[model samples]
Target: MIVVGAGIAGVACAGELVRAGVPVEVRERGRVPGGRLASRRFDGRPTDTGAAYLTADDPDFTEVVEGWRAAGLVREWTDTFLAYGADGHREVSGPRRWAAPRGLRSLVEELARDLPVTVDRPVTSVRPGPVVDGRSCAAVALCVPGPQAAPLLDPALTAATRAVGEQRWSPSLATVLRFPSRRWADFRGAFVNDHPVLALVCDDGDRRGDDAPVLVAHTTPEFAAGHLAQPGAAGPPVEQAVRDLLGLPEPAELVHVHRWTYAKPTAGGVGTYHLDDEGIGLAGDAFGKPRVQSAWRSGRDLGRALAERLLTVGG
Candidate 1:
């Protein structure tokens, strides 16, 4: 079995296959795993620039989160977020949001600990017979964003790939700012409403429980789209918006901008996964809700189904 992409979905699927005694290899284009659950080091501190937090209401996912919590890989970040608009800011409470001290990426890395993951080996194409990058495989799982997976599918699987491609994915520009001091308002994060440039802002210090005076902000999809060609160009507006939102006089000491072409799925996924008779499968957050837990569930379920089919054939 071959799994493309090492995001949560891909790692979860590979983990299940390993547990089922199936030989599997994971290929990731990025230098590291964790596509959206990305974290980077800024000024020697880990900052979550991609996913804000993990929220789970499903029993099975909650149990998995609990296990991660027990292992000290995850912790409850917060249940409330401040919604900012023209009127004012209001606190909205929801399910507990989970965070990892080391970084969100560590969760996927932990799950992929025992799996055989080949980083920097991007599969250029997936043909019938479940061939990946011209290599024949019994089964192939494309656990990446729909837009990304779409181009890789062979023309023969147009129906499957087209359905995956048609799914709308919104882009995002994440700006990370490190201030000289924590002079902002006393809030973990804020959802900016009616903002022309910014959509969300998170205090990296608060989210990681480190009080590091770092802020991570995400631009609106519209704004991101306009600046996709030059992601760094989107930084100034976002920085200005953050400064204005927090009533700050000056910019941060350091500013870094990152671009995500397929940040989130605008619409719900087709289903848990798309497994055609050709033995080609698609699984990811795009196949369900745009959530980390959903990606894991989609991949796990697909991995189980593939394992059953393979086992039956072997028997």
Candidate 2:
């Protein structure tokens, strides 16, 4: 089996298949795993620029989070976030969000530690035999955003093609701003509603538990759409928006922006995963509410389903 993605979803699927006594390989186009759980180092410190944080509610996913917590890879962030809208800024309580001291990417890396994962190797096509780039496999799982997966799938594979076609995605930009010191009121995270440029912002220092005077902001889909070509160009505006929202006195000393063309699914899928007679599987956050847990569950369910089918056929 081949999983053509190294994100949490892909790694989770591979883990299940391996437990089922199925040999599997993971291929990733990027230099590292993590996908949207992306984190980047700036000034010798890891900052979460992709997903602000994650929440766990499912019993299975809660167990996974507990493992991450015991391994010192994750920490309970906060249940409350400040929401800024037309009226004013107010604290909103929600589920307990989790964060990683090392960065969310580390969690994905930990899961992939024992898997046969190949980085920087992009799979070009998934053909009729469920072949990956001309190599026939027992099965192939495309654990990626539907927009990205759509291009790699051959039109001859109707089941997978139709699945990808029915999905819709949106884009966003994550900006990291480093200031001389923390000048704004302390807040873990903030939701900027009705904002022209910014959508969400997090105090990276607080989130990382490092006290580093750094802030990470996500741009609205509408704003991100215009700056998709050059995400770096969005840094100034994103930084400005953050400063304005938080009423910071000084400008950021440094700013970095990362682009997410398909940041999230616009709507949820009908099922947790998709598997067909073609022996191709599709799993990702798109399969349910777009979240870290959703991606994990989607891949896990798909892996179990595939293992049953393969084992039965072999028997």
Candidate 3:
């Protein structure tokens, strides 16, 4: 079996398949795994520019999160955030959000530790026999965004791919800024509602459980779409918004912009996964809610179903 994506969903699926006694090979287009659970370093400090945090209400997922907490891979961030609007800002409470000391990507890396993942090797296409990039395989799982997976699927699975592609995905631009010191007010994070340029901002220092004076702000989907072709251009407006929101005196020491063309799915997909007799499967956050936990569950559920089918056929 070949899983073409090294994100959490892909890794989770491959992990389940391997545990089910199925041989699996993972492929990723990027240099590293984690996909949207992405993290990077700026001036020797790790920053989370992708998923802000993980929230769980489902019992099974909560169990997995508890395990991650026990292993010291994740920690409870906060259940409250400052909500901002034209009127003003106010504190709001919600479910517990989980964060990683090393970075969100590290969690996915840990899950993929035992899997054989080939990075920087993207699958060109998925043929009818579930062939992956011209290599014959019993099955192929495309664990990517709906729009991205649509093109890779063969004509025979057009109906499946079309349904998968129907889900709308919104783009986002994340702006990371490094301040000289912790001059901003004490707040773990803030949700900027009714803002034209900004949607949310996180105190990276607080979220990462470190006092690094770093901040990461995400642009609204509408704003991101306008500057998709030029991500860097979105940095200025985002920087201004951050400063205005936080009331910082000085400008950031360093700033960077990252674009996610398929940041999130607007609505849940048709099902947990799409699998046909041809052995081609589609699984990702698009299959459910646009969250890390949903992605994991989607891939895991699909893996179990596919494993059963393969085992029965082989028997």
Candidate 4:
């Protein structure tokens, strides 16, 4: 068995397969295996640039969160987020969001530590017979966004191809801003509604629990769509928007931006995963809500199905 994409979902799937006694390997196109749980180092500090935070509600996923918490990789950040929109600025309560001290990427890495992952090797295609780039495997799992997975899947694989085609994705730009001091309110995160440029903003210092004057802002998909070609150019407007939103007294000392072409799925799929007789499986956040826990569960379910099928065939 082979899993493509080493994000939390992909890694989770691989872990299940390994436990089931299936020989599995993961191939990731990125240099590292974080997928959407992306984190980058800025000024020797790890900053989250992809997922803003995570929440655990499902019982099974909550258990996984407990393991992370026990390992000191995650901590409860906040349950309330300030909403800014036409109505007015107000605080809204939601699930308890979780953050990582070493950055969200660390959580993905921890999950993948025991898996056999090959990084920086992009698979060109997944064809009929469930072959991955001409290498035949017992089964193939494409754990990526619909837009990304669609390109790699051969048209002959109708089920996988059609499923990916039905998915709608949106893009976003995550900008990191470093300031001289923390001048914003005590809020940890905010959701900006009806904003032209900003969608969400997180206090990285607060999220990291380090008290460093840094902010991470996610741009609205509409605004991000215009700057996908050159994400760096979007940094200025993103930083400016954050500064204005928080009424910062000074300009940021540094600005950096990362683009996510398929940052999120417009809607969730009817099933947690898709597995066809062709031995091709599909899993990701698209299988459920666009959240880290959803992706993990999607992959988990897919892995179990694949393991059962393979074991039954062997028997």
- For each of the candidates, the C-alpha root-mean-square deviation to the true structure, in angstroms, is 1.1, 0.8, 1.0, 0.9
Listed in order, each prediction's TM-score against the native is 0.98, 0.99, 0.98, 0.98
State the C-alpha lDDT per candidate.
0.88, 0.92, 0.89, 0.93
Model 4 ranges off by over 4 Å? none
Which lDDT tens digits does candidate 1 get at residues 1-315? 999999999999998899999999999999999889999997678888889899999898899899899999998988899999989989999878888888899999988888999998999988888788778888988898888988888889866676686688999999999989999877888899989999899988888888888999999999999999999887777888899889998788888999999999986457788787888888888777788999999999889988988878877
- List where candidate 2 sits over 4 angstroms from the true fold: none
Q: List the residue pairs that clash in candidate 2.
A: none
Per residue, candidate 3 scores C-alpha lDDT tens digits across 1-315 of 999899989998998899999988999999999999999988777799899999998787889889889999999999999999988999999989999998999999999999999998988888787677788999988888878888888778765667666778999999999988999888999999999999999999998887889999999999999999999988888999899888888998888999999999996467788777778887888877888988998899888987998888887
User: Model 1: residues >4 Å from true position, as ranges?
Assistant: none
Instruction: Order the numbered candidates by lDDT, best leading.
Output: 4, 2, 3, 1
Model 2 C-alpha lDDT versus the unseen true structure: 0.92
lDDT of 3: 0.89
- Scored by Cα lDDT, where does model 4 land? 0.93
Q: Return the TM-score for candidate 4, rounded to 2 decimals.
A: 0.98
lDDT per residue (tens digit) for residues 1-315 in model 4:
989999999999999999999999999999999999999998789999999999999999999999999999999999999999988799999999999999999999999998999999998899998888898889999999988888999999998888888889999999999998988879999999999999999999999999899999999999999999999999888888888888887999999899999999996467999999999899999988899999999999999999999999987
- As a whole number from 0 to 100, the lDDT of residue 292 in candidate 1 is 90
